[model samples]
Target chain A: MNNQIEIQLSAKRKEKPSFSDLKFGKTYTDHMFIMDYSREKGWYDPRIVPYQPITLDPAATIFHYGQTIFEGLKAYKNENEEVFLFRPEENFKRLNRSSVRLCIPEVDEDLALEALVKLVSIDRDWVPDVKGTSLYIRPFTISTEPNLDVTPSQKYRFMIIMSPVGAFYKEGMNPVKIAVESEYVRAVRGGTGNAKTAGNYAAAMLVQEKASAAGYSQVLWLDGKENKYIEEVGSMNVFFKINGEVVTPELSGSILEGITRKSVIELLKHWGVPVSERRISMEEVYEAHQNGQLEEAFGTGTAAVISPIGELFWNGEIISINDNKTGELSLKIYNTLTGIQIGKEDDPFGWRVKVE
Target chain B: MNNQIEIQLSAKRKEKPSFSDLKFGKTYTDHMFIMDYSREKGWYDPRIVPYQPITLDPAATIFHYGQTIFEGLKAYKNENEEVFLFRPEENFKRLNRSSVRLCIPEVDEDLALEALVKLVSIDRDWVPDVKGTSLYIRPFTISTEPNLDVTPSQKYRFMIIMSPVGAFYKEGMNPVKIAVESEYVRAVRGGTGNAKTAGNYAAAMLVQEKASAAGYSQVLWLDGKENKYIEEVGSMNVFFKINGEVVTPELSGSILEGITRKSVIELLKHWGVPVSERRISMEEVYEAHQNGQLEEAFGTGTAAVISPIGELFWNGEIISINDNKTGELSLKIYNTLTGIQIGKEDDPFGWRVKVE
Candidate 1:
């Protein structure tokens, strides 16, 4: 196969739908980019086809064993009508990391970057210009082996699907209350928790329900051994502010290394805000809260740049942070990230990867 | 459903194929049992339909998030044409336990047991009369809501699918070599490790591949916190013999409480084999190997009653057990399990539930 990508556009296109007529992930664009791989043939059949349902055997490995991994990024439309990806190379790196853990073959970095550019360039109109909206790009790989035994699939498919999504904070970006889940574990050490696999997301549903039932927005997962130290929030990486110093949980074997978490650290360091990636125990957080030293708590992810956590419930006790309001470091870092993402400020760190 | 199951059976009858043509999970019978639950409608629409493809949106939770769980059991055929399930009620109890953790609605125990019996009766021809072969049953539930956000699915479908399976061991039960996975953790504390979900299976694939690459059969998972204590072998629960006593990992949050493991324990107890479930640390196992106290090790699962572990690769060292041969206890357990399953002896505990 040649290094060049061939553009075969979809003949059938859907009537353009308004961004308002869409939900988070319920609506999709007219086209999708797909590529296949096998041992006999490396990578083949790269095309942009009309978005349609994928036909899988009832016994496909993905359905039975959950051999799947995915990535979430966005194509932002700047005022100058340019489609840009915020540090797409980071997503590419993370995608391969996830692939290695799921036993799926990794894609060529050059080829994957080219495919992302081609997909976004052809579907540029899907990039919504709403303040908090963007063209959400989902790149995923699934094991398509037609076997019943629990083993890694020999064949896989990498696909890029685009969906126009609105503000993550549908009502408003109010501080969220969370329940600290001490009983269940989403991922353990020597597990695939760091990998953005479908299993990790699926495994979190029960704990998420428990959090909601406890009248909290999400659950803060503790370490797998003792369930005492804060690990992560699954979808997002967590951070805490104590006496104006930023402290996030040190990446144990199970916590996901989020792209947003990385960017937040760099941004805070660049802005000269005190930061530390050390072990942050729940007991310490509670003690700091009681001593009026815990000033802020927020979660960072692709969907939400920064979501402030106002109240937290642990061991049948509830504690509030920042007077139940978003914090100073959070607002500053959020401004910096979105500014660099939307081409409104200088990309000192060269985090923005322009598609066109 | 009525107090008595009003089964709507499919008229289509599948011709029985030769027992030699049995595959692991490919072929299925004519009818499958199904029951559904809704917020308004609680556990309605009990029917037996011809095996068919389930039509679902591409964005369904099962396809993306992997919110799926399944239980595996088998029906064995005896010489006198009697069919029995090896402790099927245990499977039902475990299934509901998994459902509670996944937040999926649970079916009535009596109704579920009845449905299992009815389904097995309808497909009794698939059960092989061979000593080691039987018809495998897979009862699974999946979240079917077509949405992309991170929340529990409201709609779910409970289904039972049966497939004719060959023997796990063709000629005789052979010992297997295992690769000790030090890098990955399958399940963690305070997570869904206890639940039988797709994520846990998917999480073990990478390690499984690694073990297979190194000419090993399975990977031994370590505790997520320390990666030292023995947890499980992913699909099968592991057992170790030290000083002539059998010790398996305690039912910690991360280990799957396998039906075969429980049954073997019961069978051994009845036969006066000392057995205990406690936290067996890897340090103890390794030290015992050096002390010549570690005699034999094996794993138990639905597919295989007892698979002996011939060797283990841990920390760049290979420890051989039983001289790469099947142990006495392993063969005894396998014979007992297969005997009880095939109804060759008196089932004192009434573990065998009659299918036909």
Candidate 2:
């Protein structure tokens, strides 16, 4: 409640990684933000401590029950060495939403935002300035209670760790191939699918491995109950340009409410492009492609910003779009979004927050 | 792959809890068993060390992705002070099955069983000898890789921790009231429902809390796809006696293949009772009750052994079974199964494995 953070600076900072050759989430910064919560004390002991290993009891609820939630966002450094975070408030808000679903306590968004700004400022040297490089921030909460009861935990820890990441794809902005997965389902209505919890990602690993083995970058998941309607592509929200109209899956209870997906819709609407959020089935998409109405398709997420979908493998058929190249609108949206992120373009919507 | 285990006993043991006043999973033994796995070395390091907290990087996959699996069994002590594990080999085999589903590497069942037996033998003094008590054995595997990628981890830790647990229910082996969960689904077909994974349990917490708040011991889950067929009760499998026949939901993908449930069916068959495994819908169950044919209902799991269901709350109606008392068959099953566990009865099925 006091919003005062106890800061402990690292005695020595490690040598920075080569930004040009950095791998996503493989390198960490010098300091991290941590806050603890308990039923008796609520949320307390907010601190910025040296990045290090964390100790947990052997019987902690997290190890046995997987009671955890996480949020991912990035911090960009401009040519003038000015660091910016894009729409960070939304991430914290969504984190609270996820906590509600997972039965974990909510963190004070204002305090969390303050903590992030201070942490990024203290570790500003870790933010990469190279082209297509940024600091990937991961804020996660895990149950720390040492009990085996199948119930909500009474103790928890909220932490923010950061990593310097290279571009999401090795081929830069080239299109990727995604295979449609029909065997394993990610989430369903009245489930934790919409929440950014650990279990959802865990459920997708096996299927993603299979897709990768088949030479696809990711897998497109359908609705859990029927396995017909498109829910998401890998972990990102998907969009399609059909008959010159922009359409994406509705905010179904089973699909994650991605922040970037919201921004893409707003940006399209702002540009006078017709965009709609509705249930679009895989059958409908294939039929549209058969009718030559499928124009472009891409996925929106914080990791890639915009990943153009060039080829889709479904039912043993390979459907290539836009001649297996990035769509014109996809490139424009990527450039504009990345520009706005780096403070190169005007922040018409006041989406950027400085790290100072 | 040497099966020889390195051992380091605890220098000083902690005070043992009173067997009559024990709590489930609250008091642990002095030492624990551990095995480490890496892609390069496989599962190599096998050791028994002092029970202590584990250190992990903040970015460990288990914290953010819930890449973990676990198994539960019990070790009982007879009057002769000899310890027996109730079908522990089955638990390890099921653990490997869960690993396959969660994309975790499967442990050698024989090796895991050997480690568990050895660990339990060393901690035999911790086994409670009370009428309704045993040493709860938790064998779990967690991803230890410090990476943010959504793929399966290459590093893992398998551990066995012992806890002296009292009776699962504070009221002894009495019947429990169950509320039908129609809102939050535990898991769906093609999901992690059948796996003994952390994510499945994590997804059930919020609903379990609601059930507890509403004056119910647990919630009876319906199928996620249609919410019509009976799936499970809490984390256990359920059965009903209708018209002199015992019926349970079949081994559907969304229901856990409970070892206790299997033993119960076998015991029923051994007694020449008519038992069937099929899709048991709530409507059919209610109809059977209305027709005065639903004789008994119970849940089966390792924790409770056999939990009789006395009342069901669904659609604003209370369906009281067996006059809100434990049924004859329920009591007989609980007594027989628990008797066999503690070596008080004939081990006809060879379910008990000695810790020697």
Candidate 3:
């Protein structure tokens, strides 16, 4: 399909938000990318129009059946005015995998990447040149058919929206407190956990809210079956450093395959640090802490590259890691990943793709 | 809060679809009920207006986080042209339970029920008067806040839309073939399986589509943990008659509390049938079938009052139930439930609520 994307620029541009006061996903760029899919025509008519509200029938499957998938990546601007994206191809690839799990149609990854580059190029001014801010790109697909049947939709819409987000953490890379959830489970094996879909996040909200009310920043979920194996923390993949070795939960079909998690593992291996991807249970962490071997723990995701764990509360027991301060290794990983993302470090892994 | 619902009738009535060719949820009535919820005002501004499309920001929480819940019920028109709702209060009650699980705010059940009845009364003309037809009512709530955060939304919209649906089975109450799913599990014990939310349905689509492709009407899901116990079939609750006794899966935290399932149990008990709700593993089911003790199987839901399962395919083996015919008990339950719904039988259970 020789599908050339059509561009329709906005007639009047709106005032952009100040980068200093930018909040995540609260502001949008001048233009957005959209494409439609149908069982009869597949995906067609790719277009970039002004960012605006989307009108849908109240009975659209997205609202009633939650047939949606999304990917989050950012376009970074350096002091040299050059824009770069961090491993965006992987996001589109993962999006297609999510589509298969939700029974949505697979998208053309190459075409989707082309569309992303074109969209960023069209809205280049929105990319922030500040120290820690970047233009967050969100590409999502939703079932648009107005059918109430509990079946795969026959029509869909794929869209890309941009938001200039400030630093994830207001202060420097500080550690956060997270509570271990015992009553609620986010996802399980043979479920939609591996897919970057909406339901998984929805299922975790109540637990997160309760944890937040108790003065914790996030909730750490345990496995659904035994409720002993650690899965993930909030929406991020987690890692723990015990006795001079780093270990994270393996991709056990119930945890998200985060891009940041993959990059962190790759970076650790490149640096020759001992890193293992295996099942690290909460009991093991507690025992490591008791033995004074649990040195540091942190979470990895696109939002916060490395969120240090200051404290963890599990079953009425509290374990403080690294004296409730950021660990040296956590700080190093955060700086390295961010440096590579902003073009300050050498591109040894070829993870960055230029927008121009 | 003294809330009097305001009504704004549609100026131009839509051309009603022919009752003989009506489809489920395809065509909607002229009007709909809508209410808004905000952190400060709670649920307010209850009103009924012309059915129309809803406009939302592309980053609305409902589209990204799947923060939505819905209920399905029917309004029947008896021979006297009186409209009746079958336990709609129960739907609103269940909606609140689903909202709690998804972290959305709870709505007032009494006010929502009043709104439903008022909306039905205004659209009473749209209710089909055919023998097996009724107005399918869909009451749903969605997060309307334009935010990309994984937290619960501060704003929400509750709506009710009605559709004239024809008989679920076009040709008599013919039995259907169902394949037991082994690869994809729908919901887990501690997950959002019990909630009538969008994610659960979305997760079941892939397996359902595969089963349909293999000449089955639905896919029967197994327990997510063990994959040995029966969970549900498609979107409905399942029941099996074994050794001259009626049994359904007990209300585990993972299975939906289906109103139709409750009604079936009530009717069975009222008639002095030996009914039990407990864990029934697939191994036991296969053994029963082998011993010729599996007498009948069926599913219960609002869409289909009682869907008889004529054939079951599990682990490369197929067993024809009641010689691939609708069981006598299945037919009896269907007729009794439909009779009560249409006011053809005595309302001893007080299941029906008059709309006018």
Candidate 4:
């Protein structure tokens, strides 16, 4: 282990929260991975330090300019207490992609992987044993240079923090009602929408609050230009089953390339399910519903894996899918992916990386 | 003064930079204004303290979610050493507007103005005596809650920091070459573009860098919907003088309502210049140039009251305004605005508020 990452153990451990009573991302593990980058020194001083408040100048660029990017993944535990990570490499690759778009220095993927593994291993005990609970890992980079110039910051800090998350479906997998967002535009081509940056999320919050207030679980965003084409559903990639053919929106440089979405597409392809990626329009979906061919719809992301869309409220009409119930295919995909993640099923695609 | 803003002066002062050698926003004065907000207490703890670094949990939303906004203004002094803030009330008004857009708590405008006056009065000596130098004031807010729930932070900090800035044009105000940016979108309707938020600035940095690398001083942004109508010139509101008629893009919910821009329009109207705010497209500007009707173009902002655009590069064509030199009207507007700002001109509109 010549990783050169200094480890400073906490002097006293914090009392762990009850795993069964955990919220989404409110609680954190004791230690976090820290790294610094600068123009003078590319990236140096990799260390694992006790999680505490970080000090920065009042004028740090992160507080003023939003030159920040982050990635989310999960560490799961089996009945034997064996820790596993699902497609962690994809997250680092996406992080670098986000870095190039934000003009921050691209991090070394290998070192980042090593740091994440070590950090998760040290905090392995924090992984909850509940059926659906996992340790949520957040790796983020922020511009820290203390200046008000509009250019990219010359200094940055990267850190990895872990939090214990409860089951997304505490009661059961209930399909959600979605609103077709016509007023707000989330992202457009040639924008930071493809990047996992903070600005994109910031731009979506107000709309999300409005949708939530209107008694919807999430928003299904349309393309920014014409507002006719389907782009994404909330923060997740969306898919629809029409006339026995599964279709998802193509990667058009505006919507995020979700790892879970990719896996779902692959799984459907492997199972001989007719699947295709192309431009989807809400009008076409409505037409299909009018023709009585609309079958199922769902969203995919790292947090919930498969969030079935039961109903869509668009243009003063409510379009129900599959009688507003969790589609059978959505449940199968969720179970298969979670099983592969938690070591309960055979890993045919080699998606899981086990911790030694 | 029952403002309830406790003042704590610094024990010792650092050496001030030479006013003649000051840069933009790098150096700060000895003191700053800070106020905190919480769901339970609302906004409290307003105080003026010694300038110092701030501490926050690493998971603070400002680092990851981009929930932040800011306003920029200047404090100028005449030869008599009497400090003046040009339309300081407007900055506070815009700050609250930005706050409402970002879902942050709106600050009390009267209290904010009072705080700014007191802070500037205390650091009045730091206001540069150089003819082209003045104290740059930046009032900003950051969401400081340490959570990752993809919602608005429950905690916030609003602060005001002052820095002495050198003249934007150390030499005479030379016109700048601008590149018409058609590749990226700065903002769109139903977005945070109208708000003075950090995310909008972050979204524009990469394009600005590209334009700068291409030897242009700024990028002229087009509308996100059609990618045709002119939206902004870099961070400033743009104006064009065509065939003796001054035209600018109206505030169509997707462009910032700049204070300098508003003042420029009022000044032009006061001078009885034919001015209008309407949608002006790049094709229209090019046609006007082709017909030899294009007379002058310039950008307006707090930093440079008037930044003349001498040349524009778009679609393999070069459009020159006023033969690549500053226009006479542009010069006159610059002189008038700067004159009123430095207290050398009469305040007809009562825009200048004295810091007494």
> What CAPRI-style quality would you assign to candidate 2?
high
In the range B161-236, model 2's lDDT, one tens digit per residue, is 9999986766666889999999889999989899998888989999999889999999999998998999999999
lDDT of 3 at A158: 97
TM-score each candidate. Answer: 0.91, 0.99, 0.98, 0.99
Note the clash tally of each candidate.
12, 0, 0, 0
Worst 10 residues of 4 chain A by lDDT: A1-10
True lDDT of residue B102, candidate 4: 85
Q: What would the per-residue lDDT of candidate 1 be over residues B11-53, giving only the tens digit for each residue?
A: 7677876776577876777777777666677677777777766
Off by over 4 Å in 3: none
Per-residue lDDT of model 1, residues A154-223, tens digit only:
6777888888888776676689998888777777667787888877777778778767876888889887
Order of the predicted models by TM-score, top scorer first: 2, 4, 3, 1
Model 1 chain A: worst 10 consecutive residues (lDDT sum): A13-22
Can you write out model 4's per-residue Cα lDDT over B148-232, one digit (the tens) per residue? Answer: 8889899999999999999889899899999999989898887788999888888898899899999999999999889999999
lDDT of each: 0.81, 0.93, 0.93, 0.92
**Candidate 1 residue-wise lDDT at B170:** 85
Candidate rank order under lDDT: 3, 2, 4, 1
Rank order (by DockQ, best first): 2, 3, 4, 1
Instruction: Evaluate model 3 with DockQ and give the value.
Output: 0.85
What digit string (tens of lDDT, one per residue) describes model 3 on residues A170-252?
67877999999988899989999999999999999988888999999999999887898999999999999999899999999
RMSDs, each prediction?
A: 3.1, 1.0, 1.3, 1.4
Model 2 stretches astray by more than 4 angstroms: A169-171, B169-172
